[model samples]
Target chain A: MKIEAMPAEKAARAGGRPGSEALQRRLAVAFAGALVVVTTLSLTVFETARRALASSRLVAHAHEVLQVMNGVEGTLVTAQSAVRGFVITGDEVYLRDRDSALLSLESGVQRLRDLTADNDSQRRRWQALRDRLDERVALLDRLVVIRQTEGAGRAREFLRSVYPPPPPAKTGRIRAITGEMAREEELQLAGRMREEELASAFAVASGVVLAVLFALMFTLGYLAIRRRVAQTFGLNAALLSRTEEAEAANRELEGFSYSVSHDLRSPLRAIDGFSRMLTEDYGERLDDEGRRRLAVVREGSQRMGRLIDDLLEFSRLGKKPLACSAIDMTALAGEVYRELRTADPEGSPAFDLAPLPKGWGDAAMLRQVLANLLSNALKYVRKDRAPRIEVRGWAEDGRNVYCVKDDGIGFDMAHYDKLFGVFQRLHSAEFPGTGVGLAIVQRIVTRHGGKVWAESKPDEGSSFYFSLPQAAMSGFTDPPAARGGRR
Target chain B: MNRSRNVLLVEDNPYDVELTLRAFEQNNIMNELVVVRDGKEALDYLFGAGAYAGRDLGDAPEVVLLDLKLPKIDGLEVLRRMRADERTRRQPVVVLTSSSEEKDVVSSYNLGANSFVRKPVDFTQFTEAAKQLGLYWLVLNEPPPGG
Candidate 1:
């Protein structure tokens, strides 16, 4: 069953089995094969049965025609004998017999004519026999008249002129005609019997051939099934190994991230912790410049700590299984805005939250998106102008598109390419951030089968738009809870 | 109080040890806080084995402040071995580590840790946490008899 032309691994699992496409092809082949076998068997059985039926009908028709001809010939011979008897003895019984014989002959000839209506070959021979029967009947009537008027001697002379006595065994026209028709019917009967025999034999032969074909088809089907079973086993093994490999890689990634969380954070804690110790313990010994340097060291370490935390969060988002449900976007946005407002109590941003369309996504992830965007808006407030943030959403093209417009210090449009990139900051330390907020926004949006982008102009304003799919999308599977978790 | 309560701090980092000592001092936890640098030594001290052979198993520390990352057999293993043994089965373990990873907290709790606290980066906050931990485990909460 394995094809040598294919590679070893493929050869083991190929040839109309492993994949869905191959399975369909295999089913189609089986269907076509069965169709061909059944169609051929049906045609053979139908043709044989039709021929057998026609041959048997022919045999019955020939038998009926011969039987009718025998009655006609017997009536003619009996009528002549009855007429002779009447002429010889001047008997009334013989004349009555002749009259009855004439009636039977006439009806018999008419039935034969009707029966052979479609026979081009029998029409001429049967017509000659019909004319001869009419002549003999006319002669018989004359004899009867002679027996009534003239006498036995005159009737004898008339009969002798038409037909000789039985001693001579004369080939009379009526007898000759009937003899020829009988011979023709016998010939036809023999030919029809032969035809019936041949049709019966062919029927039996076709049945045997059909059985053999059935056996062959079954064998082929059995072999195909065996091959397919083997191929399935091979494919299952291949799939199992691939799955193990993927699981191993996933476990390794989990290990890497676990170490990143555990190992990377302790050192930063030390950096920030020691710097604070220096400022608190040796504040009097250090001058103003030295204290500022210590504060700088502490801020840098704290910033690094934030960077690590943000990156870890972003990494975890990829592996975190999503719990999706319909969310009240307006309420969620308002809640996030309230949370952000608590951070900046002195300057309250004019938070215009419109009635948003209901969104479908993981509530926690979407909440994160909202928190990041709103916090960014609140963080980048232009001190010269009052902070004004607008939250609005609308349904579009099987998605719910939400926009967070902030009239704050927007960056130049040229650097928008790096706006949602991780650690790709457009501004320097003047604007304090790890440049992971927009990246997180993009990640969450994309995970929900959506898109995120920004429209901005420097010194004017910026609007961040993100779309969440209205329904489940293909190719976006909720990942299973990560395995290989270690403490 | 001249002596508060006996506490065991399982830690590997020297810097973390110094800071923890400073925290205990600032909080005025006037007790002998025994420190074990690794998981093996912590197990040894708890079960009175290896280097802590012939050590008294009855006057056990009130709380074991454990760190997850260590050189010999990590902190989760230490908690597991402690919980599995009859002598130290009911010992109160508080996981105080810099790693705020979810697995560490969950696994520590699953391994029968009393509490899981992520050590804050700021020394002031660390000091406050140490004080609260001491107050709760040593003074406010009652320890098991003969533990």
Candidate 2:
């Protein structure tokens, strides 16, 4: 049983066992046991009924024996009365009645013998009664014949000779036989009563025992089910508490991130401010060497300011909620390129705008990603060559694939994993980036349930691809032209 | 060389005060520059109390260049008091500090400073800033009408 319960214990520990499941198992066992108990009880009741029936039959047989004995006694009394009447009146009618009583008396004696045949002592008493009845009938017959033939005087003389009113010495023996028959009838009644009492007591005791057993089983089943339910409730509560703790910790981390990003900017501003002031106030007082050193300090502070801004933005990305909306990639890309041109009028890069699929995402964030990628392509292109960038999109596998290809200084594919990591740069200081741009892009894409990857070689151009679900493309506009190039 | 037109420079760091004085010398703006190490001295000079009790209130500086971070009564409060008083309310006050915090800048501007300039860290940049400020405020910019 202990080994069998291991899986249930493991399930409970894992919070997989539902209260209802445990209760159902307990109820099933309880019901099965109840069914067995009911079957056993039915069998016991059937046996008890059979015993009771046997006892009832014995009681009924004893009652029939008593009735037969009473009939014999009545016949003997009628015979005695008829003989007296016939002797007194000397009528032939009394004689006929006495003969009919003698016939009934013989039948009663035979029935008494048949009924008492099972009891040896009762059978002997029945035989004695039969002999006495036969003697009485013969005397009555003799008395009747005398009353008919010798008339009333001779019949009286014959009755006195035959009966003599039961002599004193023979009266004891006759009373003893009658008392023995009465004792036998009483014994039969007592035996039948004892058997009935035994049967009834067994039935009552069995019923009480079965009821107590059933109650005990029911209590055990109920307690088992209750315990299992409590255990399941406890496990669920523990899981809920763990989940709450994890959520609280995540909230605290976010708050800490916001605080760090917000506070670190103050000191960085001071660094940048004082460095610029040094060059402005003492440029003439210092020599060329001092002036160049001041420029380096100013440049370092400016770079630090940019780094801090990028770091703050990266941290804020995790805390900020995304506002999703349908955006036209082609139009959005064109807008960003125009803005980039205005920002950097000296270096204009060529762009090939292909018919792009539109999708739902934060427009501002997506624009930032496109700006970063395009600007990087423009900045890192070979100095001898004019920068060429291509923006294209298409529908594939229930998702829209948007790719930004650039014929610029491409990276080795072996370092692809480092591209999306914060501050992980493949290039040297020549590439001016704080390295948080791709990290922010990856975060936004992941938040929208999309994926971003890049395919590139050392000399050849690189294409950055991102896929967005169809649901994200709900209200996007379709561009008329398939592709267009700009310089 | 106008000795009567004094400039009150309220700054905490001695190095920054030395640098400002050097920048002013390089600009050749010959005016008496009064230096107060903390907000208390600046307040003393304005109220004519403590070490400067017997000084004439009418001889107050033409401009007060206040630094926000000080040992006692910060620059904002000092500016507040200078503006509240009729005697010095019209004094041209400029906020000069190393801090470039938005809150500090906004608050200094809100407190009625004539101009706000962040103290440059590089020596050359600081020299350039001081010369430009000296030419603009002390030479070109006109003072308000007074007796």
Candidate 3:
């Protein structure tokens, strides 16, 4: 079978999906901008509302000034009429009425002056009205005194000169002055009402604009959120269906392998068996070259068998479930080295298993990993020197990395891309293998959520390092009894 | 002693059956060997049905060497049918096949197969395996009383 030459790192890189971080950042910026707009809108509305309140207050002040001015005019008219009646009829009751009106006249003018204090023009008008009222009250008082002390004839002459002299000339003087003040107050009231109306209208317009802006922003945000949700769900559903299809494909491949194991082996067995039978049953009839050729045929069939087994074993690793626990790396390496030494006695390298950091993974799988690396080191012993292998590890930065350094015939670093590829070999014949050991090692380490790589120069010793995450390693530990007996 | 009892070999491939027969002849057992090509033929031979009808109702094979892959019915179904019948439930059957996959071995044992063995590719190992089966079943293992 032609296995693809894709390296593990490149395959892992190809499987990654693009992230939604940019979309998330865009949403955050949009929300911040909307918040700023809403704050500015609220501030504008508050300023309009404050202006409207001040305008209304000014209008109320104008109304008070108008009322005080009316009261002053009424007090002046009452005092003048009472004083005139007293002089004309010589009645003491009219004199009492003139005194009481004159008493209230002073306070009414003072109140009008206080109400118009905020407006300079209205204050000046109030002063003019107060002067008029003071003069009228003084005249009325003189008339009252003449009526009481001297006689009715002199009071009558004084009143005729002041109040009853003409039909509208004397009353029109104070009334015209007060009418000017009241008209001014009324003009100011109209102006303030207009200002209040403009402020409120501005406030209402700004409120409506804010509401429309908010609604537009809300609908936009809601659509954006809904679209994002739809996109996310669509991505999830596609991912789910793709995962199911991949699973089904994996099962189909598994069945294919199962049938291939059964079907292919029988043909190879027949070839080998018949070859052996030919040599054994017809040995005397064949020449020496013929027998050797038949022997080569047997050797070829056996090698093909081994290759098939290795291929099947490589595929089987992908199907096996992982059983993870804390591993004593030192003991595992030592045991794997011991087995290698016993299995192949002639290639016993000087083994040095230094203190290794503990790990977390399936025991049998990791044992296979160690065995593959160590046996690979044993296989590539250079012709010039005695074999020397060293194994050691350390824990750093949430990971435990182990390295197996071998004084073997290392290959060139230029072919590093094919180092962990299935059935890829840099050098053949010198090293006898199907080149699946490193692939299996990489698979096991990758399954444990780890990484494996080799560093070497041609003719220098090679070093293979594999690392496991330490934080995940701390969660599982083998029992004290099982630690010693575990395979 | 049931010295002349029959040995039934259920295998579909012509080449494998020829090789197994050659191995048995080399072992010199000289017992009557009954070879069936498929699972249906094997079941028919055991129960005296179809082609083997009215021949020998009282005769039963001492051992059945069954191969998993067959033409008409697979070996697992044959084992299940054998274990279901009272006449063949206690029959000694050894599952012999080219590939002994884990699932095949598990299901074979689960269906009450007496023994399971992988057929070696090397002819020497194949001959040794045949010798061991012929000696153990025909000479050593005690057959049931009635048959």
TM-score to native of every candidate shown: 0.68, 0.46, 0.63
Off by over 4 Å in 1: A1-30, A42-193, A204-249, A473-487, B1-4
What TM value does the first chain of each candidate achieve?
0.63, 0.52, 0.64
The alpha-carbon lDDT assigned to residue A369 of candidate 3 equals 93
Considering DockQ, where higher is better, how would the candidates rank from best to worst? 3, 1, 2
Summarize candidate 2's per-residue lDDT along A1-487 as a digit string, tens digits.
0123445655657655555666688788886886677677778889888877887787777778777777767776777787788789877788788779878978877887887888889888877876776666666677777777788898787767755774333334434665677677778778777877887788778877877777777888888778787886877687667657766866776655544443453354445445555666677889999988877776776676567667757766665677776677788788887888888887657889987777677777777777877776677676767778999899998888888898887899999999999888889988788888888888778777889999998767788888788876665565333122222
The digit string of per-residue lDDT tens for model 1 on A213-295 reads 76676677677778778867877787677667767877787788778777777777788778877788898999999999989
Clashing pairs in 3: none
Candidate 2's C-alpha runs over 4 A off are A1-298, A472-487, B1-147
Supply DockQ values for each candidate: 0.40, 0.05, 0.46
Top TM-score model:
1
| Candidate 3 C-alpha lDDT tens digits along B1-147 | 332488999998888888888888899978888899999999898888999987574578888999999989999999999999988888889999977678999999999998998887777788899999989988899877655
Q: lDDT scores for all predictions?
A: 0.81, 0.75, 0.82
lDDT of 3: 0.82
What TM-score does each model's chain B reach against the true chain B?
0.95, 0.94, 0.94
Model 3 segments more than 4 A misplaced: A1-226, A382-386, A456-460, A477-487, B1-5, B25-32, B55-59, B128-147
| Evaluation by DockQ, superior candidate among 1 and 3 | 3
Residue A408 of model 1 has an lDDT of 89
Q: TM-score for the first chain of model 2? A: 0.52
Tens-place lDDT per residue, model 1, B1-147, is 122358999999888888888888888988788999999999999889999999878878889999999988899999999999888888888999977777787899999999999887667678899999989998898776666
